[model samples]
Target: MNEIIQLNILQFSLIYLLLILVLILMKKSKISQSKLLLLGTFRMSLQLVLAGFILTAIFENPHPLFTIAYVAAMVIFSITRILRKNPWLNSSFRWSVSLSLTLTGLFILGYFTQIVIGVSLFNPQYTIPLAGMIIGNAMTGITLALKTFHESLTSGRNRMETLLNLGASPKQILLPDVNRALETALLPTMNSMLGMGIIALPGMMTGQILSGTSPSTAILYQIAIMVAITAAVCLAVFCSLHFGYRSLYNQRNQLNLPR
Candidate 1:
């Protein structure tokens, strides 16, 4: 077993103080001139502590059912966050995001685990963290795509209406906006993957190397993760846009703008 290096109270306090100093600098730069710094830090610390304890308990027991349950909880929590972030979205949009994220994330994760790696029993150590990363990224992509689509539809309602009146179908009128939104959602992932090793070391790859994995092995994992993220993001964004279009049009296929 790797020796667990513990941070003394004084060290932990100094680390937190450094974080606060960084936040203060950020505020001074007008990056975020709100009390959100303190609140966000507090929430982050609390959540991390709670998650640490819960993960510790799960790691000790390490049952398959428990692992599966935790993964499901992560997906559900992520979906709920997506819905909360896009409160204006209808139920169908929410369900589509949930379904897309779960299906895409699970498919990528399952392929990586069962076919690529082929680990026996699907250990929680690998599955949970990997699934969390993929699902989290997918959630972000879906949310961004949906938000962009909704904003574009609402803002371009007049243009869309004109197009519809000119005999354009809903899909035709919306495809340009939907495609743009999906591209916007995908740009960050694409850029990160493209510039990964050249620009900066990714967190996962760095952590893997720090934890004593070989560079080759870490690179392989990083590649797999990047591919999975791309696939999941594309799937989630496409699904969100496809389902979100329904909410923007009425029974007669006319664009509905909220007055």
Candidate 2:
């Protein structure tokens, strides 16, 4: 196996060239996101640097309760993002989203780390990375699903109210929208899986191979992770969406967009 080289600060600094190219595109095209793009890039770099330090500390300590607490914090932060995207959702749906993320995330993370990877629950190296992956994917799934659902609900309000007047139940009125939202959230992962080996190598597998792990081993990990990600995202989005759709109905079973 070849030795893996680590990039020094100057070497890594070369990445700014790509950002400059992006800025140039924005300038030439009169696109208005230059400020936000720059800020987002800076924010991403800072978050990752801080995450490195925090993960190192956690790895050094490696207690089960500490790991659990850290994972819980990640879930909370993810759900906050979800709520920010769906600000009009009622409190019940917010809790539902939180519970859905936690449940699906922990289940997939546990199954992957404990069964597939044969690691202890508190093994910081394995647990933290897997938890991060699970939480991140689940967060994205719920966010996209909720956003799509909200938009569909809003844009189809007249149609929905018409159906309600026709005595259609919330389920009848919202099922198509729910299905569409779930499909939107799941489509990217599905497409990625279809193209994984042929078109694009997934990040985890590519990282493993670059780090000198065998191709077969990396492939196995990627396959397992993709399956786990699909399941987690599906379950998380479904749980949250199911609860969320119910929030569209008031106690009298009339359509009420909660304040």
On residues 1-259, what C-alpha lDDT tens digit does candidate 2 reach at each position?
7878888999998998899999999999999999999999999999989988988888888788878888888888998888888788888888889889988899889889888889887888888777887789989998899888888988999999899899898788998999999999999888888888999888998899998889999899889889988999999999899877887787666988543
Prediction RMSDs, each to the true structure: 2.4, 1.6
For residues 75-149, what per-residue lDDT tens digits would candidate 1 score against the true structure? Answer: 999989988888877666667777878877888888878887896435788888888888999988988887777
**Model 2 alpha-carbon drift over 4 Å, by segment:** none
Per lDDT, the best of the predicted structures is 2
Q: Count residue pairs with overlapping backbones in model 1.
A: 0
lDDT of 2 at 132: 80
**C-alpha lDDT values of all predictions:** 0.83, 0.87
Query: Runs in model 1 with CA error above 4 Å?
Result: 1-6, 30-34, 120-122, 257-259
Model 1's alpha-carbon lDDT is 0.83
